[model samples]
Target chain A: MIMDDYKFLFKVVLVGNAGVGKTCLVRRFTQGLFPPGQGATIGVDFMIKTVDVGSEKVKLQIWDTAGQERFRSITQSYYRSAHALILVYDISCQPTFDCLPDWLREIEEYASSKVLRVLVGNKIDREDREIPTVVGEEFAERHNMYFLETSAKESDNVERLFMQIAEDLMKQARSRDLPRYDSNTTTIDGKTSTISDFSCCSK
Target chain B: MHFEIMDYELPTNFDVVVVGTGIIESIISAAASRIGKTVLHVDSNNFYGGLSSSFNLESFLKLNIEKRKSICMEHSSLNDTETFFPINNSDFTLDEVTHQWNITNKNKNYSDEENSAQEDIIAKEICAKKWLKDDLLKESRKFNIDLTPKVQYARGDFIELLISSNIARYSEYRSITRVLTWFNNTLEVVPCSRSDIFANNKISIIEKRILMKFFTSLDDNEDLIIKDYASKTYKCFLTDKKLSKNLIHYILYAISNSTDSTLCLEGIGNTKKFLKSLGRFGKTPFLYSMFGSGDLPQEFCRLSAVFGSVFALDQPIHGLILEENSFKSILIGKQKIKAKNFVLGLNLTPDFFLNKVKKKFISRGVFITNKSIMDSDNEPLTLLLYPAENDKNPCTVLELPWLSSCCPKDTYLVHISCNQINNPEDDLKHCVKNLFTLNEDFKAFKPLIFYSSYFSIPTNSDENVNLHDFNNLFICPGPDSELDFVTAVSKAKELFLKMYPDDEFLPRAPDPEEIKWDGDEEPSDIAQ
Candidate 1:
């Protein structure tokens, strides 16, 4: 039962252009292995993993969305409810790197204002590195995002990226857990609305 | 990743090309894709659930403001509008789209001798109802207002469709918490179930007895209740029952939901439908999606995408080519994608095809307030049916509190809709005044009018046209303003059958666990 005591559950969505190795990155973090030439994600797939941050355990519900242009509508709708967004780009593919602004535009439109954003450059193991680490860091800085570069094939910084997200979310979960006057009868969530006042809504 | 789409080898061939992402078209896309049909579902708008999607506060206001392509920066630069925003059937022209806002300034110097009104945002409008613009925009993420207002009967065709297709698994369902009717010049909760009737103190025992007897009679001897009244109005049949005024009001306006001139048999049929639907899911017969009715279409879209349907947003079909007897290709931008069959929603349809059909419209109004008309332990999702008043059509008012996920925290979004008469505001004004405090009054229990707007959308469902003009293209009508989605689902099923004469329609999709995967040598994230 020690495993079931995770205090907070956060939904983390991974989105970027295709061929950026999003599935490889997720597999490397969740299962400690990466499949070479991972196929395109069909719709979306999700997995939950618990990590201990300080004294409390946090569960990360990671959603990997299909990066193909045609599936944008399906993936974009999943953006609003996400707590963190990991925008990935490929270091070897200039086109995928060039599409960072497009990915940023989608995030700005669909995700919430307070969502934590991280910029990731995947496939750093490739010999032809079209985008430099300095450029990736600068792009992250310009957009006020946290930046990290990883290679799913080498398992370079893959676990570190997911751990950083969990730690950041744990910090968020703790701050919001602070007990104030508790005058907040109103909620932004649908859960509180359901169980609160049966008299008002129910016959 | 399905990454690296080659423009040279783009998907040019499909079995069906659905041109709109609305409820009807999305369902057809899912149905077609499920039965081994290659479907290319596209919308000119950049969002899913075209005309049926939930909207944030800022975009919702911009859509109603008309011709103002962009929100002026002087007001607020919160919404970055660089991406082109195209308003569709949900967008309406505004002759008098006006608003007044008052936000009390908290950081002002206080002097006991000086008397002054609190610092406000704006104070020019004469309307008694006003909203704080800053208050609404602050929590915009909590709101999910739908362009079309609707509910689903527990055993309704749409519910059946959702259940059978397994699209219901994609969404959370909430019972329509309550039903109210405007009776005796006041809003009252209509008791549909047996327990509700007995527990309500407003209804006398004798009245309840008579109501029960009538409902029982309808079930026990429907042949007698509906007999000899085929020619006359339902109101006449009720008058002949010698029931008290209270009992008559409950049966006619609340139970049957009939007009004064509704034929007796039709009224009886409607009442029977209502009774059978009650107690099926919850106490109420109706069910509403957790977010808005907009979620229903997206659920189908999710199902379609999982089944390998290619969806593209902001890709409008300019026109289609007809060769001999069938549609050959759809002209999107400068590219022509060939398809054997086509499905289209009846919005912004091309003039070449427009000359062959007629259209109608439904007036709609959306408002956000701080409280419900009737208070209870928690906020409720309610459907209130206001009887037709003189010189106005009857209106349906749906209220979704924060729990309904249709409004921001501490707010309820009320949607009023009716058949378009003269204009939107004119047709729905009386019902709005009956349940809401249009004028500020300290003693009134009616919810304060924090925000309100009215518009009409064109629907060509009433049009009678020969399909021979474009046999391969099936046009799904824009949603008519109504309480439930019975007609919408049935129409989708009928249209689906016309094109897919022999194929099954929307069979249940298997859950992920149910699908047998080959031996897992490598754990791909999609399979993880």
Candidate 2:
């Protein structure tokens, strides 16, 4: 396999309501800069980012699903093959926070049973936050998901969120004693894994 | 499990109100929304795809058992397979499907007659154990059976639409591993690509040269060969080429994929389509979805939502407010949602408009078989065209080996579709017997049919792309009984342009990372 050097190629999907900063969270984490006033994502778009996890090169194929009620089927289709599901909601919007249960329900239906999950509260830089950090943490705890708050606008916890997902995916793969995904042609949740040279982690 | 009831209210006004989430309506919804139109897409069923959906094994079985109110269905067995199994609608719900193996006792008998247990045929050569009904029921969720079985011509409109709309990223496709033709009472792989033709040992060296010459003639159509047989049938055209009977059969059934009565022009056109489609993605000229065909409609629906199109499933438009040959508003349950343009699936077309339109039914059968029709080392995604037998029409069979994730491991999901002739069973039974075994023929080299269902789907035959009052309301036809999406895409494109004459149709949507987040700087003219 050409991607033998990379320790893991994880397919992580981001799903939430519209205007919840799902795209912003992906942008800030992968690009280190968040563009404000981003428009709605049409369909599901993805990006490739390689991160360092304890000297292991982990490439993340992050799928950013459009956060609209109409796209539930499309987003749910991605869930079945995902290694990790990042359920994001805006911290400043009450409706987005309230919709976490729906998102969790989606994960229950479409996601693989062994998929690692993370709850993200995005747009935390906004001062007028409607949902508290405790509220998000409690909800995540109830669903048995790892929780974190991020400000894609300020780039706070954005990097940590993805790094933790990569690390956790590796940890989960190890604990389950599942075969390591080193094959360049291996499909994680049906999407082809990308093989690359020295990752950005080395840089 | 059901989704948490989403408290979504319909937008009071929308640029387009699309009902029925079939491929056609879904594409129109996405195309309209891609251009920034306020779109409201809804389906009567709880799921995304109304007719062209991929259901899990249980749901698919239940759909076959449970009678659909909106869509008409009829099936019956004839000739040798006279036994009929009727699904009592009350026995099963939409979510759960039930089936028990009736051959466990037969296993003991067959094995007792030979060496050991031999009821299950698929597991004999591959493994030591036999597959039981419980094994299939346990892994039912893995199956994604399409209601309308179809494949994408590698370069067909559907593929072009997916790539152009940037929705192709949402799904994955594997090229059909082989194109098989039913010949000499067995299936033989057709040499499609140039490499396959050159390497196929089945054709003699002399025959290979003749086939290659014919293929090269079909390459660009610059030769005067087709013009000479312009008015004759494609069969005549092939005979004029001095090709052998085997070569002629391969050309008619596999290459051109047209009927014997097909004109020389249309036959050559189909041959060109087939030839041009090869090697675009792989050795075969077809691409089957890695998941299932239903993923396509959902991708389009996703594109619509990315543009902020409001979507609601299980919401049926009960009435339409028509004023002077134009629709003003639609009544969904209790809410009145107004839209400038209304696009609806033919099955869901308001009876007022559909009063005069003729309806045609496409015969379909979904079977979960234990082995591939033509077993090979790697499970193949195969497309088999069984020529019309007796009174039945030509049947197109699609085999999604377990690797396609449309069925459980060690099981192949086969869908047989054709133009309805009286009953679906009669129309498809001959073809089913050709590829699979119905009775307990232990040694016959045919895929064992674990379970099967037959139904007929009603589609509009109207080639008059527009309805009489289509100025404001457009009716998109349900799936036609074709192996490709050329008809559906052209239909969707025509409807889209009628709704938005000035805007680019499904312009390429750029990746989100390609667009800068610079405030006040509008994203490029890429499909927003």
Candidate 3:
């Protein structure tokens, strides 16, 4: 596949409590179907989907936690290279929402300071919503993150949540503020040089 | 909210269960999981790499200071047919760990000195002021100090395995820019390629011509000449070639990466390997992981996890159940996990199992300095092989700058490793003194060590034939004293083949766009 087909590629990582519908939101947006009985994602690393932002095609690589969040044993390497982190919480469960601070502390410690963060309150279709919209909005404002409420079951606001991230990242890329995208070239003593003569697939 | 342990239940049965997350065990785990094995990889420590883990400055110092307490296991629960092997976790692998700070707590001002000392080029350029220990402590999180630091040949087995298995996507790397050696009590770059040899002005025209002729002779397929000296020492062969001392030193130490007593055949092979790997990545044939060598194991673990392996860290293994000399299951905090086979790190093996195997040791020293060992306009990743002198074993030194993300800006992380003849400090003190200074009244050229640590890691000798008596148990040794992961990769492949003879080892994993869901129509079109 030719990489230049996309105007920009962004790595968007989803992290939160185990059952906070993080996987459901990703499947709903990427596969266009909310998987039923998605028990602890297995054998699936990440999903890629292409979206349009202002007549440009942008590819999003969304990485799931793979149930590592169950024990809070997520690897630190997972957060280092992420361009954007989407922190999700279950609106119906107060405990998942209460764990937001814990996850934010991890982001502060592991993720880059300039990484784009978005606060997502998932599972909003349930009637017993313990966290109101205003509460999550306040938390996002306090943490300087973008806020959105999504319901994977009803397929509500999932597309817009991802589209907004892609657009914002594209704007950053156009302004030359986003991290340089996976170029093998390195600058040494004011000279830009390509370090590798062979690509990744070459022997 | 305070962190609480959740009731996450793991499956009781697995096709394979691996107990340490070192490079070998991790590679085996990834290989097993890649070929559709239900693998559960665990480590007693909270980190991904067991003995190979990297730590920040604070954690690294804390580990050196604290003594670990061993956990007790209860054997009363085992039945008559079951035998239990308790894992000893208390014995810390690192010995004689010594860490100290040379710089004081106060930061010095260099503004006044920078204007007056124009002729003192080295000191003025490097900023004459020393950084306070408090400053390093404040930026402690930026440091990724590795207990075991290694580099990979661009065309070596490890890089080939990574590329073939497609696990290289998880991490990044920077090439080693220069290769240096200690000759005449000074540091000098070893020219490996044609361009380097031509650009070097230190060697005479006649010496360069002789070196070029010797290298070109090696490039030709001369199997008869190589075989004639197979049983002889490499030094004898170099002497027979009538090469100068400077040329022999460069070939024996830096290019061939061998000791004086290395077999002629092995030395020639190493030289061929080194020459073949050049220009594949950069000026040198080596590539270091972006963060540290410690990041390598975690990348394999990530690949294992991606292929459906269950990963658990900070979880203690209470005991292993053996039935009629075959492994059956393991106990972890009232949970029993059964598996068809078990792969464990050498450190995790029971004392009874390892009674017959001899243990070896590697001396290591880690230091944080204010400047690079060899000054340059741009920060470069350097590899130095200090050959044996005065009854000392050859030392492998890697100096990493902040651009590699192993340390903070304007600081370098220096790692010295060698085979243990004595304690770490005694084994490495000579080389450290040559490269750095611990005193406040240090030379302007030598880098000052703000912090230094010396320790020894116990490794298992290759005499592990006794461990094969058990039909289903495999023990993996820790990192050896090699500069690459060639041995570790081959060992992992060997163990993997023994376990699954029919399955391919670490087949290339498809990229994200290549994977198709069950009911996907044509691949998603972007222009919809």
Candidate 4:
């Protein structure tokens, strides 16, 4: 899809279990500044970073949800109507990595079905890997999601992850025949790929 | 010279010293100065009035007016007669324009309840009545100082009115008479309605368009401004189409074009409330402050000067050498001195004298600018959530235009405040990006404007005092130096009056204090 078709800014949410280094990943990618010491994200922190993935000044309103369970309800609310979703898991923390299925089901139900989903296995920085990168990628492939391994602390493959998502979303946004799906309940399936039905912009 | 008060006699040596010649240290050095004070006053910076000093500021203001007039000439059609331009291109900062658009429609949707609050302008007459009965008046009278009605007189002194009104009440929510409209068959406050003007001619065509924009300003869409949407409420009387256009401009011009809804609402509500209080009172002056509010402190200083109140400059007190009974202090480049009484008129931030006493004081940087970064003839008052980049020393900036009648044309003042907080550059940048517009005007005219940058000193927060004195302190450090500057000069004047009841007080500008430490002790935290 041509990137010039979209105009208005959009806010996308990234949700996953704790120890995922979601904050570090975002900081490395958006600011290009390494975190001195990464800490667990406390509450909701959002960053509006302009990316050149589609050769346009597209501002991505990236909202990072806290991983703590008590914050689940708060994070759940942001899932509604999000243009895209990045459900991440820590490869080192098997418990967090295991929660991917629940996370996917939740996004499928709460977020738009057509929402562009990307599965990220974070914390690939350590040498002694807990969850194999192949397993994570296989899991993503099975679920029809584009998967990639990232290390926010070490600054590895972080840019490519967001750029790929942004590129994919721009393609969908550029399609004219695509029917505008409700914000929640949309998925990344190719069947609804017809670009004709999509209207110009709501504003 | 040094004065050391030791065992009723003076000591010849000192540990720390503070310098600079301004009223900010008046109370701080008064008692110390009284007893063979070794206090040093220096004016190398060539400024004596501290922050309130009108000496250099006056000519500085005139230069601003000249600059603005030139811009007016550049933008005018060449047919105008008045050399004094109302407002022009150079008069605004780039940040103000971008800020204006963003604030007016940050969200893109409109809310009726919030808009109605904007509509009730509270006419001048109505405001006087409210002021007469305000509880703050009693405190003012008890203090026995006459607070000349500042409302309706000079547009600048209105800040005092708002400050006082907030003290008396009206800061909390209150219901007011408003018109409602049907949207999707549900009753909503009519977005464009005003109570000040006659109902029939309340709005004009341009005002209607502006009102529509104001209504839609709250849309969450990325294209709109959120701060301006929240900053103003435009109420319209829809019976006539002609008035809508005029009313919209009127509201747009009147409000600082702030997109922050909370800030917009608070500003408008406080303004109307101030006027309402004035209307309640019978006294209303069209042009208040025969001299200016800054004149008030200057006059007090002048009176003190008539007495034996010797003033100095450039000599900043590095630190106060306080030990047991007497506080001996050293002045910059001078020997230590002792005083009988010591009152500090300097900003009371932790670093003020904390390190002198403790020996390890850290300096926090705060930035300030007066350029019109936000849209408004009088720039919208703005606060930065944070700065843009952090590798740069993280500092916070507080921007407010000094529009007092005493101030010159389109003179936007910028202030950056920081304390102990590091890597706040991103926060500061965010604040500038979101709240202010970095327009071409700012870029072209920035060099022409002198940038007076200073670090903020913390002072005691006068929260318990009546609203008039709420934030009042001899010197309170905030994110910048002006806060301390304002506090120190004002507080010095008060303390001076107490000591010398019949002296003429001459106002002065703020001065920086040099903090002293022995080997490497941290500065004490006096700013709490």
Q: Which candidate number has the best DockQ?
A: 3
lDDT of candidate 3 over B1-528, digit per residue (tens): 222335467778999999988999999999998888998888778777866778888878887666565777777778999999887575456746888888877655433555445445544555654578888897777788888888998788998888888787777788899999999999999997777888888888888999877776774546776678868988788889999899899999889988899988888888877877777768888888876788889878888888788888877688689899798999876778999999988887777776665567889899999888988988889999999989999999999998887788889999999999988899998999899987654345688888998888887744563565787888888878888999999999999999998999999888776664565333442112
Interface RMS deviation of candidate 4: 26.5
Give per-residue CA lDDT, model 1, range B336-375, as digits (tens).
6789898887663444354455446678888877678778
DockQ of predicted candidate 3: 0.29
Tell me the lDDT of model 1 at B163. Answer: 73
Judging by lDDT against the true structure, name the best candidate: 3
Best by TM-score: 3
Between candidates 2 and 4, which one is better according to lDDT? 2
Instruction: Report per-candidate DockQ.
Output: 0.17, 0.16, 0.29, 0.01
Give the count of colliding residue pairs in each prediction.
Answer: 8, 1, 0, 206
lDDT values, one for every candidate: 0.70, 0.72, 0.82, 0.37
Clashing pairs in 2: A81-A189
- Which docking band does candidate 4 fall into? incorrect
Q: What DockQ would you assign to candidate 4?
A: 0.01
Superposed on all Cα atoms, model 3 deviates from the true structure by an RMSD in Å of 4.3
Q: What are the chain A TM-scores for all the models, listed individually?
A: 0.80, 0.80, 0.86, 0.76
Could you give candidate 4's per-residue lDDT for residues B305-402 as a string of tens digits? 21123343323233334443344332222334544333333331223223343211112222222244323332333332132133332233333333
Model 3 chain B: worst 10 consecutive residues (lDDT sum)? B519-528
Q: Poorest 10 consecutive residues of model 4 chain B by lDDT?
A: B141-150
How does model 4 fare in lDDT? Answer: 0.37
